[model samples]
Target: MGIFQRLMKNKELIPLAIIMTTAVAGASSFALYAFQKTDVVIDRKRNPEPWEMVDPTQPQKLITINQQWKPVEELQKVRRATR
Candidate 1:
C-alpha cells in the first residue's frame, strides 16, 4: 500500500526511522546556534579587549559558612555513657 505500511510490516525499520529523524533535527539545531551571536557590535575577526587586568601575586582569601541544626532537648533521648 504506502511507504509507511511497508516500514511497519518490517519490524526492524520503525525504530531506525525514528532515530534518524531525531539525529538530523538535533544536529541542525546545534549548527544554527554555533553560527548566531546576539550581543556585541565588535567584528568577530578582531581581538576583543580583556574584561579584567592580569594581576600577579594577588592576595588570596578563604571564607567558610557553616550551618548546623541540632535536635531540640524535647526530641533528645538521654543515654548513659560507657568508657
Candidate 2:
C-alpha cells in the first residue's frame, strides 16, 4: 500500500504524526531564522564627536528662569482642607 493508505490505517498515530511534523517544521524554520545574519547594521563602539563631549566639572544650563514662581503649598492646603 501507499504512504497515505498506511497512515490512514493507523488511526491513533495520525494525530501524533501531524504533531511531530508540525513541531519539526516549526523548529527548522526557527533555527534557519536564528542562525541567519540580521539585516540591521549596529555600531556598538561609536566614538562621540569633539564638540559633543562635555566637561563633568562644568554644569550645563538647560533652562533659565527670569522670575521666581510661587510654591504649590496653596494648592496642597486647599486639597487637605477638602479632604
Candidate 3:
C-alpha cells in the first residue's frame, strides 16, 4: 500500500531507482564543484612586472662574458680554501 511495500513488490524497480538516485546526487555535487568561485585574486593585467613585458617578436640578445674561464682544479682549490 505504501512506497516501501510497492518497492518490495517490484524488485526490478529497486535497481533503477538506486541508479537514478545516485546519478542525481553525482550531477548536483559536480554542478556545485564546477560553479563555485574561489577567494584567490589574479591581477597580472592591471599591474604588469618588468620581466613580464618582454618583446617576443625581437631576437634575443646573447650576453657577452668579460671574465675568462678558470680550470676546475683552481676553482676547487679556492672553494676548499674558503670557510
Candidate 4:
C-alpha cells in the first residue's frame, strides 16, 4: 500500500524513520549554516578616533631602537668565562 501504511504495519520502523529524518534535517541545516556568507559593515564617521582620522595613503615614521648583536660562539665563550 502507501508508505505510511507500510510504516504503520511495522511499528518497530517508527523510531528508525524518526532518527533518519532528524539526521537528514540536522545535516541539511549544518550545511546551510557552514556555506552561508555574512557581510560586516563598519561606520567610521559617527564618532571617529584620533588614529582613525589619519590618512591611510601617507607613510608614517616608525621609532627605531639601536641594538648590538653578538655571534653564538662569542655568547658561549662569555658564558663559559663567567662560570
Would you list the C-alpha lDDT of every candidate in the order shown?
0.56, 0.62, 0.63, 0.64
Candidate 4 structure quality by residue, lDDT tens digits, 1-83: 98789899999999999999999999999677654422111444664544535443443434434544444788679868988
lDDT of 1 by residue, 1-83 (tens): 88699898997998998999999999999667654523322454453532223222232223434544554564344322321
Candidate 2 lDDT score relative to the true structure: 0.62
Tens digit of per-residue lDDT, candidate 2, span 26-55: 999977865442322233356333323434
Question: Which regions of candidate 3 are displaced past 4 Å?
Answer: 37-83
Q: Worst 10-residue stretch by lDDT in candidate 1?
A: 51-60
lDDT of 2 at 47: 35
Model 2 per-residue lDDT at 73: 88
Score candidate 3 by lDDT.
Answer: 0.63
Candidate 3 residue-wise lDDT at 70? 44
Q: Which scores greater on lDDT, model 2 or model 4?
A: 4
Candidate 1 colliding pairs? none
Candidate 2 lands at a TM-score of 0.41
- C-alpha TM-scores of all predictions: 0.40, 0.41, 0.41, 0.43
Tell me the lDDT of model 4 at 47.
40
In model 4, which regions exceed 4 Å deviation? 37-83
What ordering of candidates by lDDT runs from best to worst? 4, 3, 2, 1
